[model samples]
Structures are given as C-alpha cells and as structure tokens.
Target: MNQFIPCGLVPRLAVTVVLVLVAARCGGGGPTTPPPPIPTLTIACPTAEPVQSTDNNPRVVTFGTAVATGGVGPLTTTCSAASGAEFPVGTTTVTCTAVDARGVSALCTFPVVVRPPPRLTGTRFLAFGDSITWGVDSPPIPAAAPSFAYPEQLQQRLAARYRLQTPQVINVGEPGEQAQDGGIRRFRSVLLQHRPDIVILMEGTNDLLSLEVGIERGIEALRDMIREAKGQNVRVLLSTIIPQRMNGFRVPNRNPFAVLVPPFNDRVRALAASENVPLVDMFQVFAADMSLLGIDDVHPTVRGFQVMADTFFEAIRANFEQQVAAGVGGLP
Candidate 1:
C-alpha cells in the first residue's frame, strides 16, 4: 500500500529526519555516558587485640583474608609480617595492602601487640651470696663488677632471648657474708628491701672457709636460707660452689680455704635435690677448666663469669619453659 503525501509535508518530514540522524551521528541524542566504576577494597579481618607472648616462647602473627572488588582484574594482596612469622615483643603494625590491577592500593593496618611475659617485665632477681656473687674478680671491684658477674650477664642474655625489658639484678653478696647470717638475719631484710621475684643463693663459701663452721653447718645454713626465701614466696635458685685449683696434692697457697669445697658442694647438691630447688651446677662448669679461675684460683675470670651467666640463663629459661608447659604460674 502507498500513502500519498503533499510536497510541502514530504520535504519537511525529510528535513526533520535528516536533522535527527545528524544529531544521532554527532552523539547528542543517545543515552548518557556511564560513570567510571568506584574502586572497591575492604579488610575482611577485623582488628584483633594484642596477644601476650608466652614465657620463654615465641609467637607468630596471624592475618585474616582481605577482599577487593570493582577494580581492574587480577587484584593483589600483601601483608607485612606474613602469617606465621614471629613478631618481636611489644606492638607491631600488621599492614595488609590490597592493590588493584590499575595500580590503585588500599591499606589496612592493625596492631599486633606481643606483650612480654610477666617474668620479663618488672621482675627483680637478687644475687645473694658471698664474694662470688659480689663479683670480686676481674677488672673493676665488688658490686660494681656486675658486668663481669653472672647475674647482670644473665639479665642481658635473658633480655636478648625474650626480647623484653631487662630485669634488675641486684647484687647483695657480701665479701665475707655467711649463709647463717643470710638465713637468720639478712634474709627478711634484704627480701623486704628488694622484694625480688627470685633469689640466686650462692653462699656457704665463707662458712666453709672458717673451718670451725664445718661443711654440715654451711649446708644447714643454706637449707635455712632456702626455706626462708621460699616461705617469703620468693623463688630460689641454688648454685653449687665453683671448684678451686690444687697443686700436686696441695691446696693453692693463695686459696687456703679450698679444703671445704668438695664436701660443701656435695651437700649443696643433696640439699637442692631434696628440696627440689632449681640448681645451677657451677661446680661442674669450672671443675675441668682451671683457667676459668682467677690467679688465686678461687674467683672467676671475666670469661668464667660469662660462662656462669650462660649456665644460669639456660637453667632459668628451662624452668620458665617447664612452668609454662605445665600451665603453672609463679614459683613452683
């Protein structure tokens, strides 16, 4: 079928159609252009509370999943301190970064605190004994010679291993202090003064030197000191007496008091075993190495002190590990 049209109407219709086509070709009469998509990034894992470090143990950081959407394909995600990596003690920033294929990145940071174990923070260790604990040997003098003593060195070692605040190691050793004096008179006062979390008892050397005091008396005094410290809720670490040098069936002239070492150390071992107190076997450490002793063969050299510190550190670390494993808090 054909429809008739006036010449004037056909010409107007054709002109209108041409105008519409021209407008469409010039892109002025089509749907509006779509806006660019918003880049999407979100942290799937919520912020987690700081976790405390276990005693003498390491802890690793764990992270949750992160998601990204609405960006270019092939998104990438990275995290600082990747999962299962050990974190140092204290607060650590675990950053999860989400990167889109368009090179756009969003960051999510959470605190992963590794709190120190109670043993490492605000804990005091008192080295209580005779001249040995006083740090008599090597360069520098007593009390001030902690740098050459086992206690201070142990503090440093522990700080390194645990990555926490170093504990205070107070040297309360007197040059000629006796164990009986410590057990009866000085124990309560010193403990009250320092309020130490632990006490390293290494007396009895002076007691044995007296000869008249006898090894049994020294042992009894040590036992008394241990009991007193334990009663006061202070952990005790008993150290065996170090060995002295002998020259051809004769005690060294400088160390005339060496006669009492063998029996005294034996009693010390027995006491520690019977009482179940932690023991640092210093006697065995120095027994084979005479060079570790000073010129007098009684006191230790600087190197010797370092070794002693290592031994004590190991024992203490082991004790802490055992306690933690057993789920026990404080002293056993």
Candidate 2:
C-alpha cells in the first residue's frame, strides 16, 4: 500500500510536525509584558494655622482632615511655624502636604485668621494691717485730697507706672487687731469678698504688744495667712514692723520699747523666707529716716507714710519684674 506514496512526501510531513511542536513550546504569541500600576495620592499637614486670643487666657484650634489615595496605613498630622516655631495672634499660614505608599508626595497651603481675646481691664489688691494701714489717725479732708494713706499712695503709683487702669485697693485693716485676730477674720471679709490678686500684710505690730504671745504663734499666724492666699492663687507681700522709739511716750522708760521689734522682725523674716513671699523691710527704711515718725512714737508722720509708700512701690516693681521674666505680661 505504501508503494504509491513518494519518499519526499514522508520527509515533508515530518518537518511540518516538528515546526508546530516548536511553536507550541514557545507560547505561540508575541513578547511577554506586565500591566501598569495604579497611582496613589496623599496629604500631610506640615503646619497649622495660628490661633489668636485677645485676652491672656489660653486658646486652642484644630487642623483640617488629611487624605491618602492609595491603600496606605496609619497617617499622622503636625503643625509648626517658620521662624520662632510659636503661634502668635493675627493672620497665619501653614503648608499642607500629602504622601502615598509609593513614596510620592504632594503639597498645598492652609490659611487661618485668629482674632484677639477679650481684655482684662483691671486687677484687685487687698491690704491687711493695723492702725497705720487703716489710716485711722489721719484727719478728715475733702474727697479730692483724701488723707494719703499708704494704700492710696500705692494705688496711685501702680496706676501711673504700671498702667493698671482703675486698680482697686481694699484696705481691711482694723485698729489694734493682731495677726491672730486678722487671720481669723480675713477669710470671710477681705479674701472672699474681692478675691484680690495680691494681699499686702502689715501685721504683727499689735501681736508684739503682748509680751506673753510667743514669736512662734505670730509665725504660725503668718503661715496661716499665706496658706489661705495660696489656696486661691493670690500673691502675698509681707512688711516688717517699723521700729518704735517709745510706746507713745507715755511709758516710764525713755528707752525704746523696741525689745519687741527685733523678735517680731526676726519671725516675719523667717516666715517670709520659708513661704517665699515678697518682703518690704520698712524697719530699715524707717530707721534711716526718723523724721517720718510722729511725736506719738508708734505712728508715722505724713513724711513717714510717704517713705512707707515708696518702699511698697519698690516691692511691687520687683514683683512686676519677676512676672515679666516669667513671661506673664500685664496685670494679674
């Protein structure tokens, strides 16, 4: 049966089968290639808008939302300024940026306007002391030229120098009241009534009159007063009792009843040092200027009151300096 088939035809058939097998092994198509990947977009907040507050109170603001185009994980936002890195009042701008899983990033801008906070007009002061502080002995005068009590003089000085507009000084001194008596009464009348920013204490003079009252008790009373003020975030200024040459010149001794002065001053100094309260050394000031004293020996003359007022002014100015250094500007 094969005698009719040609030999060349058999070879040709074999060659064709080989070529088809080779083509199949080679995948029978054009060159292999992969499809392009999808693009991802994202945003990052590099800076935040400035928040302005007119008042001294703190203010807080929020940043806008961040977005990412690709399937990325766990994004975070942050804020910063260009120069000082602190946010101040008025118009401020921040740069916003975005990143994707592919390490590609985008950038934009955020604009913010901050308004001022409400202003605090004035601060209150509370003066606690004895006869001199109460201005009890001063003669009556017209309202315009009211007898210049030390507290009144302090108020005037603060208004003029520190720019404390309409500052209020509440004198809570009671004549012949000792530290113990004043401490017991202050919580209700002076402390809670006005909630003063600062409390100036001119006490212990009457306490010294009693030879029986130990120095420790006076110290304790002073500490109590400080604790009370600290509870309400009020500052304190302690003044040393002025030296007395004689007890109203009525006593038999020509020598000073000044025995009480040294001990009382010592206790006050110790209390002030321990409690970290500001102190005005009226003793030193008055000792240098005896002319300020009146004939009564206990009370200070008009000139003496003026000197006391000057000492208080120095103390207040020192406080202002401390506040300014601590970054607290303006009145309390």
Candidate 3:
C-alpha cells in the first residue's frame, strides 16, 4: 500500500492524524483552580489592670487591649462583659471587639471598677412648659379632674423600668405663659427652688403663639435655662413642641396655620443641637398617627400623652443607665 501512494502523501496523512488527535484532546477544557479560604477571627480579654473604688466592692479586671489576626483591613471594635458576671462593687469588666472589612471579627474584654450610684436618699425632677405640658387636653374630661400629664406618666415608667425610687416630679407649667415670662420671672422662683436632679424644659409653644418670637430668641431662652441649671449642676433635657393643626391661623389673619409648625420646629431642633442637650422630638411621635390629637387639633389626647411619656422615658432611661455605669454624680 505504501508503494502505491505518493511519497509526500504519506507524510501529509501522518500530520493530519496528529492534528485530529490534538483537536479531540483540546475539546474538553482543563480543570479549574479553587478559591481561597476565608480568614478566621478570635478575641480574648486579658486581665491587666484593677480599678479602685471607695465603696467596699471587689475591683474589676479588664481583658485584652490589642486584637491580633492574620487578615488586614479596617477593623471595628465592640465590648461587653460576660453574662452572669456581677460587676464587683468597686470594679466592672468591659469587652471589646474588632471587625475587619471582610467581615472577620475579633473580641477582647476589659474591667473597670468605680464607686456605685451614691445612695441617693431622694431625687426631685422638675418639668416646665405651656398648656400641653400641663396636660391641658387630657381625657376623662371633667375639665377639673387632674390629668395625668406626660410628667406623671414618665415618673411611673421610670420607677417600673429602672427600679428607681419614685421621684418627686413638680410640674410648673403655667398655661399661656410665654418663655419670655418664664425666663423673666417664673423659672428661678419655681424650678430652681427644688434642687432637682433633672429638669425638663418644654416651653416656647406660647412664645411662638403669642409673640411670634423668632428662633434666636427661643435659643437665648433655652441657653438661659441651661445656664441656670448648670450653675446648680442639674442636668437638662429639652423637648421640641408638638405640631398644631389649628383651624384658625393667627399670623396673616385667622386662617389655617399649619405652615407655621415647620418653622417653629426647625428653630427648636437647631437650639437643641447648639446647646448639646437631649431633645425628645414629640412632633414626630404624635404625627405618626394624626388621630391622636384632640378635636381642636392643638393638644394631644390621652393616648397621645402616653406615647409622649414613653418617648421621654426612653431618653431618660438611656441617660440614667449611662450615668450609673460611669458612676458620675449628676443628673442624667
């Protein structure tokens, strides 16, 4: 058979066979490379320093200060004490964690001990405000029946949640009394007299309604209140006014006055921020369900007052807990 074929044809045929075999082999792709493994993270707290306290309690020990891991990226840290571990009377433990950008995490614990809350024999809280602050539109209307205003509700919630002794809450809200009036004559005589641990200032509604005072004046009044309170070492919590959708407007003439609400709230928010005071945004809470207000649309109903009280309770509880943990001697 080879003798009959051309000499070039044999070599060509051999080359063709080799090319076919190569094509067949290349038809299926080669195996793929595997992905890299995810990095692991671990955390620990090392006992290093002991905190001292005047109270007769065990000193607290802190855990690891630095987090070490194999991976690299931005890391976030969080700390918490172990469960069921009683913070020794004089000391407490704090745990911290570091998390990398890849979601890897590491943890550490530290101990810090200090004097506990002073055996506060008693504590007083004062609330100052306008009509709403006085529970003007509260329900079960005998018009004369005592309305459990937000302040009273706040007291109850604090007692239940924090196990704090029932504090004497004095409500000094005078209906129709503008902040100007309060700043000039009322605040000192009534509020400063009690030596309150905390003071809640809810004024400015009357100021906005009566004098149409601008935001600057409101801020000044708030500053004055804060200055007075700080002089006595009393902590202050400022609250924004709830929005009013009154039927009659007072600005350009007696028409719908809803437009005024936003401007007033803006001023109050700015004042709160500049003063570095805790602000309870009551308008948003009440505005969540518009039906909570009374028929007149200015005052919140009983349910509305409950919601307001709850809001106040949340802010107050957080502040109190922090102050307690810090062993700071001042109103939270």
Candidate number with greatest TM-score: 1
The candidate that achieves the highest lDDT relative to the unseen native structure: 1
RMSD in angstroms between candidate 1 and the native structure over all alpha carbons: 12.9
Residue by residue across 78-98, what tens digits does model 1's lDDT show?
776666677666666667777
Whole-model lDDT per candidate: 0.71, 0.64, 0.63
At residue 143, candidate 1 shows an lDDT of: 41
Note each model's CA RMSD in angstroms: 12.9, 14.2, 12.6
Give the winner by lDDT: 2 or 3: 2
Off by over 4 Å in 3: 1-122, 138-147, 214-216, 246-257, 323-332
Which has the better TM-score: candidate 1, or candidate 2? 1
Model 1, position 149, has a per-residue lDDT of 71
Q: Candidate 1 — which pairs collide? A: none
- Please estimate how well model 1 matches the true structure, expressed as its whole-model Cα lDDT: 0.71
Position 2, candidate 2: lDDT: 20
The worst-scoring run of ten residues by lDDT in candidate 3 lies at 323-332
lDDT of 3 by residue, 124-145 (tens): 7788887777777733461421
